[model samples]
Target: MSSLQSVTDDTFDEVVLKSDLPVLVDFWADWCGPCKMLAPVLEQLAAEQEGKLTIVKLNADENQEIARRYDVMGLPTLNLYKNGEVVKQLVGAKPKRLIEKEIAEYL
Candidate 1:
């Protein structure tokens, strides 16, 4: 099973935008309660969807440039990127099944 990877502003381009596999970029911050709540669900999804998708966490506080670029206004925002563009965006903490369902078309 694959584990979620952390990406910084400097690495976001190479790690996510250039990745061959679709990426689920979770935009979060340390003090956000919902972000904490969604962490485990993301971990499970990351493991289950290993080859099909890559799950990465980006700290909004630390990677403000990337966050602003993506227009992330909320914590725990999930942006699914394909071919270097955002294919879907899900805001707030969501259940694993719902998250999966939301991105099912991409998968």
Candidate 2:
């Protein structure tokens, strides 16, 4: 099935903002092509970085509030949260190496 965990506006704070491990929240929508393309990359990251990081997916269409609060202006935005604040923000579908490089410091 799905490798990535799904989070909503209600669980956003507890599951992501308050998480002990760094959280990567993917802000996306079903209709977005780039979002779909990035899903597999996210799944790979979640599998490879298990204990080091927590990966959560938020459907922008379903959780507009959280998306808006985080200033998610585009599809497939990946926001890394640490200590209840955003530490890194990556947008669009990128290669795994590039994505990892961007988040390397956080990990």
Query: How many steric overlaps are in each model, in order?
Result: 0, 0
lDDT per residue for candidate 1 within 1-107, as digits (tens), equals 22578999999999999999999999988899999989999999998998999999999999999999999999889999999999999999999999999999998
Candidate 2's error at 84, in angstroms? 0.8
lDDT of 2 at 81: 94
Q: Over the stretch 1-107, how does candidate 2's per-residue lDDT look in tens digits?
A: 45688999999999998899999999988899998888888899989999999999999999999998988999889999999999999999989999999999998
For model 2, give the 10-residue run with minimal summed lDDT. 1-10
lDDT of each: 0.93, 0.92
Candidate 1: residue 92 lDDT (0-100): 99
Residue pairs that clash (backbone atoms under 3 angstroms), model 1: none
Q: In model 1, which runs have C-alpha deviations exceeding 4 angstroms? A: 1-3
Per-model TM-score versus the true fold: 0.96, 0.97
Number of the top candidate by lDDT? Answer: 1
- Per-residue lDDT, model 2, residue 47, is 92
